[model samples]
Target: MALAMTDASMTDATITLPAIAPRHARDGKLRRMLSRMAILVITMVLVVPVGLVALGSGAGVIALPYEMFELARRAPLLFPAHMIASALVLLLAPAVILTRRRPEFHRPLGRLLGLFVVIGGLTALPVAIISHSTPLARAGFFAQGLVWLYLLGAAYVAIRARDIPRHAHLMTAMVAVTTGAVWFRVITGTAIALRLPFEPVYAASAWLGWMLPLALVLSNPRAFARLLSR
Candidate 1:
């Protein structure tokens, strides 16, 4: 009778442990999926306006890339290079973030993204100051560029020091700053749609483009914490 009871207890323990294991695995996967969806949704929200503007430009609504070329025509060649790099960063950063599923591919793509962000931010500083129309706009863009560079540098240092959690959060922050390039266009487009005054709209966008994303991070620390923890 004693041996039979012990065997029954052992069987119950084995069955319960396996049941808990599957639930934990499922919970982990669900968390990862939710986090990925949130990041991608935020990314699309930022990119859609900029994408529409680009499509319109290509269709001759805004005047192609020529309109931008005209604005920075007198600026150094770096201005165009910066614009191109900005476009690449917008495309690559989200991809880097999403490629978490396949770390082998993620590694190469991540390097490409890091390279573009560094180049884009560095090139933007000069273009913003020398080529932008208003003093306020220039200052705003310059500050955004500085924040982008700083975040990317911090992320690199974190990874180098084997601080994975710090690296993850900083990279997310860097991506947020990169999206500022997109948000600038979106804000400008909204202002135009509203027929608001050009100067104020442009100036407001310069600061808001970058600040809003950081604000979101600060507001939802737990979501970001879980994402990096994973």
Candidate 2:
């Protein structure tokens, strides 16, 4: 009787220990995944905009003549607004990168970024409409404007509903749109460096910025499954 009781107690201990161990292991794995995700988000927040600006500032070297010609043709009233909008975007790029970790700073700065996008869109879209730039350039600017508007509206909704997931999605979309400016330079630079056909490369790069993010988000397993069923 004594031997049977001892064996029963040992068996209960073994089963309980194994169950507790697995739960703790699962919790640890979840924590590690969350940490990794946080790091990735931080890196993206810092790198994308700043990297674009650095590339864009360089493009200004090659594009200066064209920009100057555009300025010469524009009304004085329109020029300063355009300059201000451009400066705001370039300056805020770094500010946004630096403040990503501070929610207090991040939220307000994000609002400002959204406002800048709207201002830029309003100022640039009409110019793009009439400009003699390639069709792709015109379409890119217009699409950028539309995306900025959507991003602004989505940001407002996210804040109102206090939905973190929605806010993240919208912000990611905004980043993708802003990245068009950078990718433009990159594609052009590559074409020039490699002595490839510049026009087609430039045109494709403009659209690819928007298309890549759309492809990524829509291709998510869960999102794809839902769309297929619908």
Q: Highest lDDT, which number?
A: 1
lDDT of each structure?
0.77, 0.63
Clashes of each: 0, 0
lDDT of 1 by residue, 1-230 (tens): 99999999999999999999999989987987887787678667757456455445433365545536665576546765676677777777767776766879888998888888888899888888776468988899899889989988998899889897778788888777777877777789889899999889988898998899877776776678777554
Which residues of candidate 2, in runs, are more than 4 Å off?
A: 1-63, 75-87, 90-101, 217-230
Which residue ranges in model 1 land beyond 4 Å of their true spot?
1-67, 227-230
Question: Candidates' TM-scores?
Answer: 0.74, 0.63
lDDT of 2 at 43: 42
**Clash tally for model 1:** 0
**Range of the 10 consecutive residues with the lowest summed lDDT in candidate 2:** 221-230
